[model samples]
Target: MCFVLYAGTSMPIPQKEWRNDVPGLSVEALTERESPIAVHFSKPEVRYIGSTSGCGCDFPHVMFQNGDWPWFDDGEHDPEQEASDRYNREALVNLLQATGEQTVELYGVWDGDFMTPPAVREEIALTVIVDPSFRFREQGLYVVRVA
Candidate 1:
């Protein structure tokens, strides 16, 4: 049950690192430069590559669309897209939960990131793809507390 976790709000700064107990999982602070483009040109086929050692954790390897692209836009998650979007999100969350990061927090997610990234809007959807029931409640979205 391999999956890619979309963490943080809006376009991630790309500098912020998401730390977790999962060993191989790569905590990337994504931004439009990497994600928006990935979705814009993602492939239609979705494949789960179980887990891998590359990231040091048992993170699932999702074969994103076209093999080269890392993300996909399954159309708008509106009324028409709700069922499928929920299915995808649930399946992804379920897999993450099963892997032990049950409390993985999906951050920076909103309704608009699904439609598209407007030049001025800039607010991208960041999802806490993991389920909330997991013990890792502390692992959800939040702004960094600065001193």
Candidate 2:
């Protein structure tokens, strides 16, 4: 869905509340289902599309990419598993900033099927993730509304 953004207002996704909303996906399912990113590939972080609120096309707005999954290694080999690094908002911002990336794309994956969504400006993603004002509603998720 396409939604226009106004006054730079954006909001972060609340991790805890989102988790409760998805009763079917267990913690393990979420963790195991995380999309893989090639480390040496050297590009902006790609995350799973969990859920989106408001408009999906809004610029500089935060989107629900994934749920709260514990970071761990199952000792199994998926090849890309070791290269795919899922950084928190802070680290992710720094990582993308260093690369000078201008945008990020959110994609959906269900039962091994994949769908590519529109791209959000890299600036907006970084801005909301680090903003402190929206931290009140950020239960592990980072976001903001610029109105």
Candidate 3:
């Protein structure tokens, strides 16, 4: 899914610069998954899709771009597990800012064969795992949202 930012919006939530601290797959490769990104909505009638495994977490066993970073082994190993958290977190933050969501609570995350209904249609609830401290560290909040 593509996140389009509105014009004249505030800078995205102050997230630390992507440190490339975790090693993982390239961004392009992950986005090609069958069930990449999932958007959720609160109204249920509203039109939105929410879930996990989008943006940089679009692929399995791989993070953003397939590259070497500090957090992971960074030596020819799958970056999905270690990098997905951060990648998806950053993507969610960017999405909220782009859509003008001052404080978005990520509720859920889903990948191929993992999300409910098998395929996300539009307008639904979501629960996501986000780092509450706004830091790239592993400790964070387990957010939930109606999207």
Instruction: Output the number of the TM-score-best candidate.
Output: 3
RMSD of each: 14.6, 17.0, 12.4
Cα lDDT, model 2, residue 13 = 20
Q: Residue 91's C-alpha lDDT in candidate 1? A: 46
Model 1: lDDT to the true structure:
0.30
lDDT of 2 by residue, 1-147 (tens): 432211111122222222434321111112343333211112333332222222212112333346422334466665432222222234334433543334432222222222222222222345664443222111122222222
lDDT of 1 by residue, 1-147 (tens): 212334332222223233445422233433444355234222221111121232212322223233232434566446533443444445444444443321222322222343333122122122443332121111122221111
Task: State the C-alpha lDDT per candidate.
Answer: 0.30, 0.28, 0.30
Tally clashes: model 2: 10
Model 3 Cα lDDT, one tens digit per residue, 1-147: 332111111232332223354432211211334322232222111112222422323322222223321244446655564465556555544455444443333222323421222121222123233442232211111223324
Q: How many residue pairs clash in each candidate?
A: 14, 10, 28
- For model 3, the stretches where C-alpha displacement exceeds 4 angstroms are 1-79, 103-147
In candidate 3, how many clashes are counted?
28
Ranking by TM-score: 3, 2, 1
